[model samples]
Target: MVRALLSRARDMLDGIPHRWGSAAIASSSASGHGAEDAVAGYVRMLGAGVRPDAYTFPSLLKAVARGAAAAAEVGGAVHAHVVKFGMESSAHAASSLIVMYAAMGDAAAARALLEACPGATGGAPPPVMWNALISGHNRSGRFDLSCRSFADMVRAGAMATPVTYVSVISACGKGKDLLLGMQVHKRVVGCGMFPDLRVGNALVDMYAECGDMDAALVLFEGMLVRSMASWTSVISGLVRSGQVDRARELFDHMPERDTVAWTVMIDGYVRVGRFREALETFRRMQFCKARADEFTMVSVITACAQLGAQETGEWARIYMGRVGIKMDIFVGNVLIDMYSKCGSIERALDVFGDMHNKDKFTWTAIILGLAVNGRGKEAIDMFYRMLKASLIPDEVTFIGVLTACTHTGLVDKGREFFLCMTEVYNISPTVVHYGCLIDVLGRAGKLKEALHTIDEMPMRPNSTIWGTLLAACRVHGNSVIGELAAERLLELDPDNSTAYILLSNMYAKSNRWKDVQRIRQVIMEKGIKKEPGCSMIEMNGIIHEFLAADRSHPMSKEIYSKLETVLIDLWNAGYVPDVTEVFVEVTEEEKQKVLYWHSEKLAIAFALLTSESNVTIRIVKNLRMCLDCHNAIKLISKLYGRKVIVRDRTRFHHFRHGSCSCKDYW
Candidate 1:
């Protein structure tokens, strides 16, 4: 249809009588790729002596802007002809030149054109010309200049039109200028443009993006009419302010929802760590038959990655393909991350290999994915490959590199990467980098070196840093430094349950019964509840969750019976239960029983009973794998000859043939 319209427009232009005032050459909106032909036809008409009028230059300039790199030269040529024709003083012609210059990002030329105006009409060259100036700058992301131009327009005794207010307010919103936005709001109201739908929406957006959610909500509520943009702006703003629940409430109340609206809610849930809710929202979107776009897919994929719900994520990927959503760079990057986090490293590699265009983020995602999946050497190799591809590593890329070295016991290599991050890349080391370095040193039993590194840090250590040191101390059984680390951690977070649990577990493993009892009593008195351990398995797009000794599944009877038989067979095969992992005051037999009913065991049992004999078993657990479960699963993998992948809080553990990919380090 667009081609037919362009053809018809050309035929009309060719029929012109080629005389002064015989016809005005006006092209339709010609401002996208390949409209240069229309501009050339207009030039032909001009040479044929169809004298141009005020309205002719605007269309000609609009048409010329479609010429790609040649637009600037053609626009200048057209401007010279407009001068020869004495249409330079026409407000339409001058504003068209401004628009043309602005489209070229020639801000100085655009300003020069604007300055040459106003003297012709005597006061700011009319509001339409000023509107063109401000809107051009706003479109160019020069929000500062847009606001300044709007202020100058007002000072020049020119009243802004609705178009002017909308562009300026949008500028204020995107520029994050709340004060100027409020002043613009007052002007909008004073000029009686507040009720205009476009102006009102711009005001709401201004308030929202400036982080004034209260004002945004109030203004939104008071609007007599609301569009999807109004609702989307407020909801996304609420999400930005960490009021995700309120944003969801407003989202629920929206009269209709589009893909962007649904995507904002899903992304909000993901940002707040509500992964289950995020996935559930995606399900609801599908149920409502709402269209999902790439943004929607990215949010859903991210939710699946966080939850380790590989099956659901795969469904999303397939759905995108069925729905004709292109596998662009963003979708590909996130897919690699999703598969990697879900312990599907082969799938991650496949996605990485399949991507035709790779950016810094694409390489970063795969590098981090490999690091977390216990493939440190491959991650390092990927990093060098990324550099070979001419991609400079960012802060996130370095984090993955440091993690790879830490897990692989390459302390010296980790230190080298850390130094390179500063000296070579000119990237300053953050606390996260420092913590990774400490973990590298601590895991290698260089406890004193880790402490000295901490002391030499440029900034104060946060709880995460202290916690990392304390964890290392527990691993090496250094009670004295462990005590100091624990004290520092406790001072940072008075009622931190993880710190208390780690200290108590360390004491229990060392047979310091008194210290364990003391920490346990303190935890009880403080009413600090430990995070209950849980594990999840995703099969056929349904996530099944299990807690310790859970009996809620329909297959509970068979699962428990299978687990019992499996444990017995492993025990007979020389699997001794590591009761030292039972971090509680219980009898020896009770601790062994408790270890048998752990959440991961139940998940494993369920997986075994429901899956095919040759199928790999994957589990995602919230907490770190305990010694008893880790040792038991290793033996289970070897005996059953099933590759089992478990993603715990810290990293991945790939168990096969009675050995772990972490090599017993993590």
Candidate 2:
């Protein structure tokens, strides 16, 4: 019965085209399920004296590409059979060898096969053979050779197809060779392949990756037949180039949305802190019944974290479980961030502990979550565990560890980690790395050391680095560093309004009325205006965006009335306005008015009027929460008996029962 069944199966398979049979085998191998079994079956077929032909080679080559441990042996047997059949010099067999070796990540073998193929020594190889070789080099990460191969093929008068241009465009993106990519674009147009969607999509992606949005847009507009990939590449390119509005427009016009499209748009909106749009798009995706893949889930989790959506985040966690997708390291990391941002450090720890295979990203996410949550000691402990697990610390990992130290006023520990990051890991500090250390020292009131750090940096200090020092000056009330830091910040960012605002605020705090007026004169002269700080809070699945003191909402009256009640209670509890934070040439009454309309306060008021009494209120801010807002929110949490989670530009602030996760550092 088994013999009869085998015969019948073979007969059925024989009735299919060889290309179809090859595709089936390749798909199975690519899926990683059929590697060893396929190899053994191929060996058994050989033992049965089945005469394998060219059609059989792609399947065997596919198995070799799958990187099974026995690839070399299986491929060698196939090569030997080709030689025995006197087909070694055949273009078909040689191309197969090149593809097989490339898949094996053995670029050397692929090159040898190309050189030895008939007519390859002097005359041009067939385009098929050239494509196979170039593709192999590309997959093997030998982009230089891939590009060289494409050029050589074209120079030899081989016809360039859309696939050829796509491959070359991909190589250009990898090498960041913008000039060469432009040459490829010219050649693509010269060859009358200008409107090919695949080529157009590849060109758009290449340009986008190189930060050339204009070029990408030009190609995108010229394409006649746009597929989902074409739309996504352009949309994502726009987002990456900071043309968020254009990206959103394109997204709204896409005929159909795929998981990539949904995830990319959500990621763009979340990156710019447009939480309401991110959540609404996510809802639209759900309504369209698009299954959230892991990437999509990760993007949405990040958005939720930014908005401090504890209930929504937990609901997403349950939804992920229902979808039967196992939580991988990326998903686990995002979950940790979400829970920590939602004021549930215990849940963050649970996700960290349950992760099956934790990578550096996984470690960094959990550690950063703990650090941002003000559990600095636990974050430091986790760093040690990561070292014990033999995961080398990268620049980002140290940032988390050092930030934890900064938050807890662990000056000594922060210094040790900073030194060890350079000495032990041999990882040179970047500008960002220096910025973190400056923040650490400045936060500890080590103004002198922070100044020294600024001087010692190899690269010119950016406005952000100087801004850190200035911020520390504000906290420590150090006039000297504040002046010098402000000068440095202005020099670095001449048009930056934030630095001027900070400087003016420092001058006002010191009662320097002349300096404040002078700063205001400069701001007026330069026509520089401060962007109003705004915060958004999501309530009942609708996002409520508020500008500082905004009274434009439908429930503005009630929100302001609630704000008045909170302000009365906060004042009775000894809350005083940090009048200097207004940082402008305004009357005291005007300054207080400005403070009252600050975005976070407005968001808080809105949350109070609209949300359930005991429910946690989540707010997201575009910048760091100001001192007054932070202090006021703490009091409001206690007065209202509510938890308020706020996500600022850099990290999360979980305020509950009058305490914050950052323990006031953030």
Leading candidate by lDDT = 1
Model 2 residue 552 CA deviation (Å) reads: 1.8
Alpha-carbon lDDT, every model:
0.84, 0.78
Per-candidate TM-score against the hidden true structure: 0.82, 0.76
Error of 1 at 6 (Å): 27
Pairs clashing within candidate 1: none
Tens digits of per-residue lDDT for model 2, 182-299:
9988888887876777888889888987888888888778777889988898888788788889999999899999889999998899888786678788898999998788788888
TM-score of 1: 0.82
Q: Work out how many backbone clashes candidate 2 has.
A: 5
lDDT of 2 at 127: 75
Residue 107, candidate 2: C-alpha displacement in angstroms: 2.1
Model 2 residue 129 distance off true place after TM-score fit, in angstroms: 5.1
lDDT of 1 by residue, 1-666 (tens): 323422433444333334311222222122332344556577576678688888888887766653333355455556666666788778788888787776666677777677667654464567887888887777667799899989888898777899999999999999999999999898788877658889998988899999998899899989999999999999999999999999999999999999999999999999999999999999999999999998999999999998888888999899999999877678999999999998888999999999866889999999998888878899999999999999899999999999998888889999999999999999999999999999999999999999999999999999999999888888888888888999999999997777887787678768898998788778767888757889998877788999998999898999999999999999799988886546555688898888999999999999988888687788999998888899989998999998999999999999999999877655
RMSD in Å for all candidates = 7.9, 8.0
| Residue 518, model 2, lDDT | 88
